[model samples]
Target chain A: MAMLTDLLVISAANRIIGLIRDVFVALDPDTAQAVEVLLYFLVMVLYAILCELLLNGQTLGKRIFKLRVVDASGLRLEPSQVIIRNLLRLVDGLPMFYLLGGITCLLNTRMQRLGDIAASTVVVRIPEVSHPDLDNVLGSKYNSLLEHRHLCARLRQRVTPEVAAIALEALTRRDRLDPVARLKVFAGLAAHFRELVDFPAAATESLGDEQYVRNVVEILYRAG
Target chain B: MLIDLPRFVNAERPHWQALEAILKRFENDPDLRLPIDEAQRFHYLYQRTGSALSRISTFASEPELKQYLEWLVSRAYSIIHGQAERRRFHPWRWFTVTLPTTFRRRIQAFQMSLALTVLGALFGVIALAIDPEAKSALMPFSHLTGRPSERVAQENADRGKRLEGRKTTFSASLMTHNTKVAIFTMGLGISYGLGTIVLLFYNGVILGAVAFDYVMDGQTIFLLGWLLPHGVIEIPAILLGGQAGFIIAHALIGWGDRRITRAQRIREAAPDIVTIIAGAGVFLIWAGIVEAFFSQYHEPVVPYGIKIAFGCVEFAGLIFFLWKGGANSEQNNSSKA
Candidate 1:
């Protein structure tokens, strides 16, 4: 929905700009030729500048919707990559409104539009909340109900220092993990902690080990 | 954390009763917010959901996991879809990348078009040389006969005397005629192949006959003065246009007895056709400028040399630049595979 809206906005902007340029040229025949050439160069330059600076490496519409452009590895996109991707829009938009491009994107695993395939970039949503920020729940209004530092010490007793450390590290660097690896690490830690806490099987399964681990951390932080 | 216990527990399960007992204990303890351990547990559960969702391959047949899977899928879909929306409208970055590639491709196509045109021209000249009588058959006799030639000479002298009064209609008429001829030469290529050949032959015969007439009229100097100035650029443009026509024909007609679908052939040929048309436009523009300004009033010696130099440049430029397809390196690597 956001991507579609962004596209609409950009298309509208393009049409408006084109109309303005046309009107400017029509006012003076001799000057119109010169203006036409100048406008073409100007439009190209403006497009580059707007995309690089304002969009977080995305174009104006992209920035508005909190979308980010990244490389195949999901790192920040390079300017050249951005350029290549945008330029391939011609191919994407070829023979009409991106029919070929849309097909290519549908066929690809990454769901790359024509430009993305050509430029080798991916568009991904920036996570709204980082894992570490979950710790802040302890400091919120619920602090009186739970103690954080004592719970951390209790957690330390339940699990080896090394295991706790690994869990903390995994959460801190969650972004680095592929989805599968992240799940495995989190699930393993949760299950281990659940055994130490000796929660009933019914509670353990329903809440799940991973959720249980998160609840412990949050409760401890609030109590601190 | 306000855990939604009812949503997760199956009422019929014996374990659900035990889970409710534990939940009741926590509920009675007014100070018991979710434990830190519990929060960590939930976090891990969320991560598991993400992982399971990501491993779409494993869940292909697991109908029981559909609801959980749908949740995960929707979240990921929203993220990606949102990102796409943001980037869709702002094509400047994409345009930057695409424009240069398009430009380079177009330029390369133009060069190929030029080379093919020269080859076509050479073939037409050969055809003319082989059948000299065809040259006379194609030539415009009104411009060549003694009385008409003498009358033209008188008119030229009168025009020179009253230079400012001379009508530009003559130049306009010539322009119109040349443009029509060029278009016919190019457009007939659509007739599969024969039309292109005929166009090429007609052009070659006319050029040869014109040269022959000038040489016979003891006005070789005048002919050089008149034709050389614009012929240099104009002739190559026409020849290149002819070449573009020939390429279109070749693309339409498969080279050998390979069974290829017409649609497949057209798709493969689309890029070349676009390139040819673009090249033709450029050539026509250059031809117009040359004929309008330079051809009508240039010194014989300089114009003749310019004409020869222009032809050589066309030949060298095309051969050096466009013959190697851009995918050659990729092909080499792929062959190793």
Candidate 2:
């Protein structure tokens, strides 16, 4: 994100300077030619200083990518830290194309550029999120196993939480699976449950693989 | 009666949704402020979501709810803990402490660059002495054609003067030019340091040949007077660039700790690499000022001895400061830092 903004700032400055130079060349060629390099350097320095100060730890590019500059402790980024990092950015930008900074970033576990290390700042990813609907997975209420509340309690004691969650997810996602896949998934889940609990043969005799899974979900979540 | 799964979800779903809502707002706007009630509720919901995740992961059949809560909790954690109101520090400390310390760490790389420049200069001088008529080949006259060097040499031969009133403008341009060169030298270390070496050697050869050219032309006094003032500062500035370049090269080649990846070691040394480059930049600017205004304009007006003496002083001061200025405490704090 930071790199993109830097490019924009540099190119914009160049265009503005180029226009002024054209005017100067027509008016005072010598003066314009002499100050060209100086003008560009000053603009570049000012660009770096102003962008960091005004943006509050985010460059135009950084904001676009949802990456923010923060202190190492995951706290607020300090202005000094920002300066240190940016100052070092010149070094990182050496030989063109941030090759030095890129190498450093790839090496470090934190993915910090040269500036990031000196300033004790980190670039963190701020992910976009939304509310997830629960109706599809939690809508069902009927449970044939409700008659065996005591048995459900025993099953809960025997089945660990991890095993129960897996069973529920498979059952919720049952309709999405192909018939062959559905049967295989249920068989594996049933075998896993059977290992955890020794249910009576009479309870299981008539139950298909999907029905057996449904009964397990009922016993775990619906039965008291 | 069967335990009502929907009823259980009904009780907890509002909390999860509320948490999600506040976190979503923060994600969109990091600086956004929530109402006092919402702020406290946000924290409360985060805690609830954490507990709910463990619970759902254990007993609940609603995997999606557990997943939702987990995502909300993590986002909340990033916001609540990361929204730090920034503090300020002394900027001077960065140059005084951090920069010098970092440069000091890579002293070996600087030395290597210095050696290359010096060797190149010696080679040029030797090559020129072996054949005085080699001036055309030795000097970069092809590049100098119509450039400032050609004009400056012509004027100096006539009136022993050049760049009289345009010193500031020229210095500014030279400063920019030198800085670019220095930075380029430091940055090219990634190419196995090959580019850096070639640049340093090429620059050294130019300086050496130029020195020999002035000697042969009987302009030795004028050349010394011209180059010393700025060369004292400028030469070291370029050398520092070479040092920084070599530092990058060192990192690339994996100078230490085979157990860790080469890139990791380079990251560890990134601070030093930048510090050296920055210090070099400062010197280059100073050198440019001396070159455009002081050195080039000093001849006839300023005695050659005075000019050379001034150059020597600047050079000696640089060496002293680089070697001894912050050595005492750096030795003690080196490992800790």
Candidate 3:
């Protein structure tokens, strides 16, 4: 879109300049060429400036890809930063393709191009409409399990977020497991959680391996 | 008692779907007003989703469902916490103030760049004078002119021809070409500045040889008239590109201070680098126009003496700009601020 606008600006300006020069000064061939070069340069530079200013750092292509240009530090995007980055685009889009820019992105932790590095800006993938399955399982935000204070206190001391993630993964992907695999997995998890604290025998007595995992998850993540 | 998983999922599906609808509404248009009741419902559903994500780990819930809630919550969190305000653009302040200030601050880097280029040019002149056949392994510009100045001189005498007065690429194409070459000088400098080193040397070599060609043909005075019309600005612009390239190479090689990471150094150097290179690109645009329209007016349209005189003025103007332009502005800025 930037290039398109640049092209339009150049054509429009050229025609207007031509009309005035012809009517007044009678542009020689040399003068006409000079005017063309000047207009092309102005349009090339201004296209980027105008597009970024109007669209908040999103050009036509960026908008199409659902990518947004934002400050890396999460500060509001500043015009100076935008100008710096857009100027550096000449460097990033080099050697026929974005080969240099691509290599830079691969090397940098934030995947920044030269312009991005200069501007302290990043191109982020906008978050999209997400799936609905989580609401079904964690229904109505009620964690009655929290009301069981003794069990909750025990669970907290035993479970870390990472370990709980493992338990969650195993349970959610249970259908993918072999019957024998499921039994061994749950048994190992039950042993792991049990080792964290010496819970009363009453909590363990009625629960099998799978039920033990579920009860532990409920206790660990219950709403406050 | 063990819960019937499928039965529970059936009963819970509507609430999950409803929560998704609310989050989507907010995500689609962050400023879209939500009534008080709907807002409370959205918050309630968000909390429920968070709780489900935690417990579903052990519930044998579908993996896809878990992923869905994870994404939804993360999206919601970003929307709530992230600053997404549209930025107001200020073209005047940035170009006039910030850019010049950076240019002034990076004077030393540009000096280093100038020193390197002069060294390369000296290398080209001396090496070619000694052995025209002695070619650097990487010499792309040599084909334009270099080494066999005697041969080019002979051809020029025999044909009574020179590239002077000959039209080159169209004005726009020439500007584009110059811009690409200058930008590449800065970009490829990342290879420990080696690419920049070679390219600069190669350019100087080509230039030295071209001069040799004209001189051997006994057209030194005329060539000066032709080249200086645009070279006054064009040469400096290319040199500015070389300076920017060296700055990038220095950042990559960790020649800079170690208090900051290499990335941070690049960030610091970038404004100055951009200021010079952008200036270079703008210069090339003017150079292209001159080469197309004025530089060619050497023999007939304009006298050679006057063209040479015009070139001298352009060169003197350039010298004044570079010598004092950045320094004066920096002083002015400090005083103003």
Name the candidate that leads on lDDT: 2
| lDDT digits (tens) for residues A34-132 of candidate 3 | 455555555655666666656766666566666667667554455545766666666676665667687889999988887777567787765554433
Q: Tell me what TM-score chain B of candidate 2 gets against the true chain B.
A: 0.71
The order of the candidates by DockQ, greatest first, is 2, 3, 1
Query: Which candidate do you rate higher for TM-score, 1 or 2?
Result: 2
Residue A79, candidate 3: alpha-carbon lDDT: 54
The CAPRI category of model 3 is incorrect
**Model 3 lDDT at residue A106:** 95
**lDDT of the candidates, in the order given:** 0.48, 0.70, 0.64
Model 3: per-residue Cα lDDT over B133-212, one tens digit each? 55443245545444444543453453423433323336666777787678767655665677777777667766665665
- Candidate 1 lDDT over A1-224, as tens digits, reads 55476567656656665676578655654344444443443344346435643454556556666676665543334444564455445446545877977887889898877556434466766444222444532233332213334434344344543454455566667678998887887788777776665544543455644455555554322222
Which lDDT tens digits does candidate 1 get at residues B123-216?
5456546765555455556555443356436634543343232223233334444544554444444445466566665566566556655565
Clashing pairs in 2: A1-A61, A1-A62, A76-B84, A107-B263, A161-B58
In the range B218-291, model 2's lDDT, one tens digit per residue, is 77776777788898788888888888778767766766666775535554555577667778888888888788
lDDT of candidate 1 vs native? 0.48
For candidate 2, give the docking quality class from DockQ.
incorrect
Off by over 4 Å in 3: A1-135, A138-147, A153-158, A197-199, A221-223, B1-104, B132-169, B250-256, B259-264, B326-329
